[model samples]
Target: MNFHELLLCEGNTLEKEKGEHVFMQGDSDKSLYFIQTGLLKAYYTSSSGKEAIKSFILPNDFIGSLSSIYAGQNCSFSLVSLETSMLVKIPFEKIVEYGKKDIVLANNIIEFLMRLTLKKERREHEFLCMSAEERYLALIESTPILLKKITQNDLARYLGMTPVGLSRIKKRVQSKMSKQGENNP
Candidate 1:
Protein backbone atom coordinates (compact mmCIF):
# COMPACT_ATOMS: atom_id res chain seq x y z
CA MET A 1 0.00 0.00 0.00
CA ASN A 2 0.96 3.65 -0.48
CA PHE A 3 2.07 5.89 2.38
CA HIS A 4 -1.23 7.70 2.63
CA GLU A 5 -3.13 4.44 2.41
CA LEU A 6 -0.86 2.99 5.05
CA LEU A 7 -1.54 5.97 7.26
CA LEU A 8 -5.24 5.58 6.84
CA CYS A 9 -5.18 1.89 7.57
CA GLU A 10 -2.45 1.64 10.17
CA GLY A 11 -2.12 5.02 11.84
CA ASN A 12 -4.12 6.43 14.70
CA THR A 13 -5.57 9.91 14.84
CA LEU A 14 -4.34 11.88 17.81
CA GLU A 15 -5.61 15.22 19.08
CA LYS A 16 -3.46 17.61 21.08
CA GLU A 17 -4.70 20.64 22.91
CA LYS A 18 -2.79 23.87 22.81
CA GLY A 19 0.38 23.68 24.93
CA GLU A 20 0.35 19.90 24.96
CA HIS A 21 3.53 17.96 24.37
CA VAL A 22 3.76 15.19 21.78
CA PHE A 23 7.05 14.21 23.36
CA MET A 24 9.76 15.70 25.51
CA GLN A 25 13.51 15.85 25.18
CA GLY A 26 15.26 12.77 26.58
CA ASP A 27 12.03 10.79 26.44
CA SER A 28 11.57 7.49 24.63
CA ASP A 29 8.50 8.46 22.60
CA LYS A 30 8.75 6.72 19.23
CA SER A 31 5.81 7.77 17.14
CA LEU A 32 6.04 9.61 13.85
CA TYR A 33 3.35 12.19 13.37
CA PHE A 34 1.85 13.58 10.20
CA ILE A 35 0.24 16.87 10.99
CA GLN A 36 -3.28 17.37 9.65
CA THR A 37 -3.83 20.84 11.14
CA GLY A 38 -2.48 23.45 13.56
CA LEU A 39 1.04 24.43 14.53
CA LEU A 40 3.77 22.72 16.49
CA LYS A 41 7.25 23.66 17.63
CA ALA A 42 10.35 21.50 17.89
CA TYR A 43 12.85 22.82 20.40
CA TYR A 44 15.93 21.86 22.33
CA THR A 45 16.78 22.85 25.85
CA SER A 46 20.29 23.05 27.16
CA SER A 47 21.26 21.80 30.60
CA SER A 48 21.72 25.41 31.59
CA GLY A 49 18.03 26.00 30.86
CA LYS A 50 18.36 27.85 27.59
CA GLU A 51 15.81 26.93 24.95
CA ALA A 52 16.48 27.02 21.24
CA ILE A 53 13.79 26.46 18.67
CA LYS A 54 14.70 23.94 15.97
CA SER A 55 11.75 24.61 13.68
CA PHE A 56 8.03 25.10 13.46
CA ILE A 57 5.92 22.35 11.92
CA LEU A 58 2.90 23.25 9.83
CA PRO A 59 0.11 21.20 8.37
CA ASN A 60 1.20 18.39 6.05
CA ASP A 61 4.57 18.12 7.75
CA PHE A 62 5.98 14.91 9.15
CA ILE A 63 7.90 14.98 12.44
CA GLY A 64 9.55 12.36 14.57
CA SER A 65 12.70 11.60 16.47
CA LEU A 66 14.65 9.27 14.25
CA SER A 67 17.20 8.64 16.98
CA SER A 68 14.57 7.39 19.36
CA ILE A 69 12.78 5.32 16.77
CA TYR A 70 15.66 3.85 14.78
CA ALA A 71 18.56 3.84 17.20
CA GLY A 72 17.02 3.14 20.58
CA GLN A 73 18.05 6.56 21.89
CA ASN A 74 16.06 9.22 23.67
CA CYS A 75 14.52 12.16 21.84
CA SER A 76 16.93 15.04 21.30
CA PHE A 77 14.26 17.69 21.30
CA SER A 78 10.70 18.25 22.41
CA LEU A 79 7.66 18.51 20.19
CA VAL A 80 4.73 20.49 21.44
CA SER A 81 1.52 21.96 20.12
CA LEU A 82 1.38 25.73 19.77
CA GLU A 83 -2.31 25.41 18.91
CA THR A 84 -4.86 22.63 19.03
CA SER A 85 -3.43 20.09 16.58
CA MET A 86 -4.78 17.10 14.71
CA LEU A 87 -2.28 14.49 13.62
CA VAL A 88 -2.01 10.97 12.37
CA LYS A 89 0.39 9.05 14.58
CA ILE A 90 2.14 5.95 13.37
CA PRO A 91 4.72 3.82 15.02
CA PHE A 92 8.03 4.24 13.23
CA GLU A 93 8.77 0.53 13.39
CA LYS A 94 5.50 -0.32 11.73
CA ILE A 95 6.28 2.00 8.84
CA VAL A 96 9.70 0.44 8.40
CA GLU A 97 8.21 -3.04 8.52
CA TYR A 98 5.63 -2.18 5.89
CA GLY A 99 8.20 -0.39 3.76
CA LYS A 100 10.26 -3.55 3.46
CA LYS A 101 7.39 -5.15 1.54
CA ASP A 102 6.25 -2.07 -0.37
CA ILE A 103 8.69 -0.37 -2.70
CA VAL A 104 6.50 2.70 -3.16
CA LEU A 105 6.07 3.09 0.57
CA ALA A 106 9.79 2.77 1.17
CA ASN A 107 10.53 5.35 -1.46
CA ASN A 108 8.01 7.72 -0.03
CA ILE A 109 9.60 7.46 3.41
CA ILE A 110 13.03 8.03 1.91
CA GLU A 111 11.78 11.14 0.11
CA PHE A 112 10.31 12.49 3.31
CA LEU A 113 13.60 11.99 5.14
CA MET A 114 15.50 13.66 2.33
CA ARG A 115 13.28 16.73 2.50
CA LEU A 116 13.73 16.93 6.22
CA THR A 117 17.49 16.65 5.84
CA LEU A 118 17.60 19.43 3.29
CA LYS A 119 15.60 21.71 5.54
CA LYS A 120 18.00 21.03 8.38
CA GLU A 121 20.98 21.80 6.19
CA ARG A 122 19.43 25.08 5.12
CA ARG A 123 18.78 26.07 8.72
CA GLU A 124 22.37 25.27 9.60
CA HIS A 125 23.61 27.32 6.68
CA GLU A 126 21.47 30.25 7.73
CA PHE A 127 22.85 30.25 11.22
CA LEU A 128 26.43 29.78 10.09
CA CYS A 129 26.48 32.21 7.15
CA MET A 130 23.62 34.71 7.44
CA SER A 131 23.58 37.78 9.59
CA ALA A 132 20.81 38.17 12.16
CA GLU A 133 19.20 40.88 10.07
CA GLU A 134 19.43 38.78 6.94
CA ARG A 135 17.87 35.82 8.65
CA TYR A 136 15.00 38.04 9.78
CA LEU A 137 14.53 39.32 6.25
CA ALA A 138 14.52 35.80 4.84
CA LEU A 139 12.04 34.69 7.43
CA ILE A 140 9.81 37.64 6.51
CA GLU A 141 9.96 36.79 2.83
CA SER A 142 9.38 33.10 3.38
CA THR A 143 6.69 33.01 6.03
CA PRO A 144 5.15 36.39 6.68
CA ILE A 145 1.85 34.78 7.59
CA LEU A 146 3.63 32.90 10.36
CA LEU A 147 4.65 36.22 11.89
CA LYS A 148 1.04 37.00 12.65
CA LYS A 149 0.47 33.63 14.27
CA ILE A 150 3.52 33.47 16.52
CA THR A 151 4.75 35.71 19.30
CA GLN A 152 7.60 38.19 18.83
CA ASN A 153 9.55 36.27 21.45
CA ASP A 154 9.22 33.06 19.51
CA LEU A 155 10.08 34.91 16.33
CA ALA A 156 13.24 36.29 17.88
CA ARG A 157 14.20 32.90 19.21
CA TYR A 158 13.66 31.31 15.83
CA LEU A 159 15.77 33.98 14.20
CA GLY A 160 18.57 33.45 16.72
CA MET A 161 18.33 36.86 18.37
CA THR A 162 17.17 38.42 21.57
CA PRO A 163 13.77 40.08 21.48
CA VAL A 164 15.41 43.50 21.76
CA GLY A 165 17.74 42.74 18.89
CA LEU A 166 14.86 41.59 16.72
CA SER A 167 12.93 44.74 17.56
CA ARG A 168 15.87 46.84 16.40
CA ILE A 169 16.19 44.83 13.22
CA LYS A 170 12.49 45.28 12.61
CA LYS A 171 12.80 49.03 13.04
CA ARG A 172 15.76 49.19 10.69
CA VAL A 173 13.99 47.08 8.07
CA GLN A 174 10.81 49.14 8.30
CA SER A 175 12.72 52.38 8.06
CA LYS A 176 14.52 51.15 4.98
CA MET A 177 11.28 49.98 3.40
CA SER A 178 9.55 53.27 4.18
CA LYS A 179 12.35 55.30 2.62
CA GLN A 180 12.40 53.08 -0.44
CA GLY A 181 8.62 53.33 -0.77
CA GLU A 182 8.73 57.13 -0.66
CA ASN A 183 11.55 57.29 -3.22
CA ASN A 184 9.82 54.85 -5.58
CA PRO A 185 6.54 56.75 -5.59
Candidate 2:
Protein backbone atom coordinates (compact mmCIF):
# COMPACT_ATOMS: atom_id res chain seq x y z
CA MET A 1 0.00 0.00 0.00
CA ASN A 2 1.02 3.64 -0.50
CA PHE A 3 2.12 5.89 2.33
CA HIS A 4 -1.05 7.94 2.22
CA GLU A 5 -3.19 4.85 2.39
CA LEU A 6 -1.15 3.53 5.26
CA LEU A 7 -1.54 6.80 7.09
CA LEU A 8 -5.29 6.88 6.50
CA CYS A 9 -5.68 3.26 7.53
CA GLU A 10 -3.52 3.29 10.63
CA GLY A 11 -2.79 6.84 11.69
CA ASN A 12 -4.59 8.87 14.30
CA THR A 13 -5.58 12.40 13.46
CA LEU A 14 -4.82 15.31 15.75
CA GLU A 15 -5.93 18.90 15.67
CA LYS A 16 -3.42 20.97 17.57
CA GLU A 17 -3.95 24.62 18.30
CA LYS A 18 -1.30 27.26 18.07
CA GLY A 19 1.41 27.02 20.77
CA GLU A 20 0.72 23.36 21.45
CA HIS A 21 3.75 21.11 21.55
CA VAL A 22 3.78 17.84 19.69
CA PHE A 23 6.86 16.67 21.58
CA MET A 24 9.58 18.26 23.66
CA GLN A 25 13.27 17.62 24.04
CA GLY A 26 14.01 14.47 26.03
CA ASP A 27 10.56 13.06 25.36
CA SER A 28 10.43 9.59 23.91
CA ASP A 29 7.93 9.93 21.10
CA LYS A 30 8.30 7.27 18.46
CA SER A 31 5.76 8.75 16.16
CA LEU A 32 6.04 10.44 12.78
CA TYR A 33 3.68 13.30 12.16
CA PHE A 34 2.35 14.09 8.69
CA ILE A 35 1.25 17.68 8.58
CA GLN A 36 -1.97 18.18 6.67
CA THR A 37 -2.31 21.87 7.25
CA GLY A 38 -0.77 24.85 9.05
CA LEU A 39 2.76 25.20 10.30
CA LEU A 40 5.01 23.72 12.97
CA LYS A 41 8.36 24.79 14.31
CA ALA A 42 11.06 22.38 15.33
CA TYR A 43 13.50 24.03 17.70
CA TYR A 44 16.26 23.23 20.11
CA THR A 45 16.54 24.67 23.60
CA SER A 46 19.93 24.93 25.17
CA SER A 47 20.47 24.07 28.81
CA SER A 48 20.96 27.79 29.39
CA GLY A 49 17.45 28.34 27.94
CA LYS A 50 18.32 29.84 24.59
CA GLU A 51 16.21 28.62 21.71
CA ALA A 52 17.53 27.91 18.21
CA ILE A 53 15.21 27.30 15.34
CA LYS A 54 15.98 24.02 13.65
CA SER A 55 13.48 24.15 10.82
CA PHE A 56 9.90 24.88 9.93
CA ILE A 57 7.58 22.00 9.08
CA LEU A 58 5.11 23.09 6.43
CA PRO A 59 2.00 21.42 5.13
CA ASN A 60 2.65 18.15 3.29
CA ASP A 61 5.77 17.53 5.28
CA PHE A 62 6.60 14.62 7.55
CA ILE A 63 8.37 15.35 10.81
CA GLY A 64 9.71 13.14 13.55
CA SER A 65 12.71 12.74 15.76
CA LEU A 66 14.71 10.22 13.78
CA SER A 67 17.05 9.39 16.61
CA SER A 68 14.22 8.97 19.04
CA ILE A 69 12.19 6.90 16.66
CA TYR A 70 14.97 4.69 15.34
CA ALA A 71 17.47 4.49 18.17
CA GLY A 72 14.97 4.46 21.02
CA GLN A 73 16.50 7.59 22.50
CA ASN A 74 15.01 10.77 23.82
CA CYS A 75 14.02 13.42 21.33
CA SER A 76 16.74 15.90 20.50
CA PHE A 77 14.41 18.73 19.53
CA SER A 78 10.94 19.99 20.30
CA LEU A 79 8.07 20.39 17.84
CA VAL A 80 5.24 22.85 18.33
CA SER A 81 2.41 24.23 16.27
CA LEU A 82 3.11 27.76 15.11
CA GLU A 83 -0.53 27.91 14.01
CA THR A 84 -3.50 25.64 14.40
CA SER A 85 -2.45 22.45 12.62
CA MET A 86 -4.06 19.24 11.45
CA LEU A 87 -1.81 16.20 11.39
CA VAL A 88 -1.78 12.46 11.10
CA LYS A 89 0.34 10.63 13.64
CA ILE A 90 1.70 7.19 12.97
CA PRO A 91 4.13 5.07 14.87
CA PHE A 92 7.49 4.91 13.09
CA GLU A 93 7.63 1.24 13.87
CA LYS A 94 4.40 0.68 12.04
CA ILE A 95 5.83 2.32 8.93
CA VAL A 96 8.95 0.24 9.18
CA GLU A 97 6.93 -2.95 9.42
CA TYR A 98 4.96 -2.09 6.33
CA GLY A 99 8.06 -0.99 4.49
CA LYS A 100 9.69 -4.33 5.10
CA LYS A 101 6.78 -6.11 3.53
CA ASP A 102 5.91 -3.68 0.75
CA ILE A 103 8.33 -2.50 -1.87
CA VAL A 104 6.28 0.57 -2.66
CA LEU A 105 6.22 1.57 0.96
CA ALA A 106 9.95 1.00 1.28
CA ASN A 107 10.61 3.18 -1.78
CA ASN A 108 8.47 5.93 -0.40
CA ILE A 109 10.31 5.88 2.89
CA ILE A 110 13.62 6.05 1.04
CA GLU A 111 12.44 9.00 -0.99
CA PHE A 112 11.31 10.84 2.12
CA LEU A 113 14.59 10.20 3.89
CA MET A 114 16.56 11.42 0.88
CA ARG A 115 14.64 14.68 0.80
CA LEU A 116 15.07 15.12 4.52
CA THR A 117 18.79 14.47 4.24
CA LEU A 118 19.19 17.00 1.44
CA LYS A 119 17.41 19.63 3.50
CA LYS A 120 19.65 18.95 6.48
CA GLU A 121 22.72 19.06 4.32
CA ARG A 122 21.71 22.37 2.78
CA ARG A 123 21.09 23.82 6.23
CA GLU A 124 24.50 22.66 7.39
CA HIS A 125 26.13 24.19 4.34
CA GLU A 126 24.34 27.45 4.96
CA PHE A 127 25.57 27.56 8.55
CA LEU A 128 29.13 26.60 7.73
CA CYS A 129 29.78 28.26 4.41
CA MET A 130 27.37 31.18 4.08
CA SER A 131 27.08 34.50 5.88
CA ALA A 132 23.86 35.37 7.71
CA GLU A 133 22.97 37.80 4.95
CA GLU A 134 23.57 35.18 2.31
CA ARG A 135 21.47 32.71 4.25
CA TYR A 136 18.70 35.28 4.50
CA LEU A 137 18.83 35.83 0.74
CA ALA A 138 18.77 32.10 0.16
CA LEU A 139 15.80 31.76 2.46
CA ILE A 140 14.02 34.40 0.44
CA GLU A 141 14.72 32.63 -2.81
CA SER A 142 13.85 29.16 -1.51
CA THR A 143 11.07 29.84 0.96
CA PRO A 144 9.89 33.40 0.65
CA ILE A 145 6.46 32.63 2.07
CA LEU A 146 8.02 31.42 5.29
CA LEU A 147 9.40 34.90 5.94
CA LYS A 148 5.90 36.33 6.04
CA LYS A 149 4.55 33.55 8.22
CA ILE A 150 7.19 33.55 10.95
CA THR A 151 8.04 36.24 13.48
CA GLN A 152 11.16 38.34 13.01
CA ASN A 153 12.79 36.96 16.14
CA ASP A 154 12.21 33.40 15.04
CA LEU A 155 13.56 34.23 11.59
CA ALA A 156 16.66 35.74 13.15
CA ARG A 157 17.20 32.66 15.25
CA TYR A 158 16.84 30.43 12.23
CA LEU A 159 19.31 32.56 10.31
CA GLY A 160 21.76 32.47 13.24
CA MET A 161 21.65 36.17 13.95
CA THR A 162 20.28 38.56 16.54
CA PRO A 163 17.03 40.35 15.78
CA VAL A 164 18.86 43.68 15.69
CA GLY A 165 21.31 42.30 13.16
CA LEU A 166 18.45 41.03 11.07
CA SER A 167 16.88 44.50 11.17
CA ARG A 168 20.09 46.02 9.82
CA ILE A 169 20.29 43.42 7.11
CA LYS A 170 16.70 44.00 6.09
CA LYS A 171 17.33 47.72 5.78
CA ARG A 172 20.42 47.13 3.68
CA VAL A 173 18.57 44.70 1.45
CA GLN A 174 15.65 47.05 1.01
CA SER A 175 17.91 49.98 0.20
CA LYS A 176 19.78 47.92 -2.35
CA MET A 177 16.57 46.67 -3.91
CA SER A 178 15.15 50.18 -4.21
CA LYS A 179 18.37 51.45 -5.80
CA GLN A 180 18.36 48.58 -8.30
CA GLY A 181 14.74 49.21 -9.13
CA GLU A 182 15.42 52.90 -9.73
CA ASN A 183 18.43 52.07 -11.92
CA ASN A 184 16.36 49.66 -14.00
CA PRO A 185 13.63 52.22 -14.54
Best of the candidates, TM-score: 2
Please, what are the lDDT tens digits per residue for candidate 2 over residues 16-50?
A: 99999999999999999999999999999999998
RMSD of each: 1.6, 1.6
**In candidate 1, what residue range of length 10 has the lowest lDDT sum?**
176-185
Candidate 2 overall lDDT versus native? 0.94
* Runs in model 2 lying further than 4 Å from the true structure: 182-185
Estimated TM-score per prediction?
Answer: 0.94, 0.95
Clashes of 1: 0
lDDT of 1 by residue, 1-185 (tens): 78899999989999999999999999998889999999999888989997778789999999998889988999999999999999999998899899999999999988988988899899999999999999999988888989998988888888887789999999999999989889573
Write down the worst ten-residue block by lDDT for model 2: 176-185
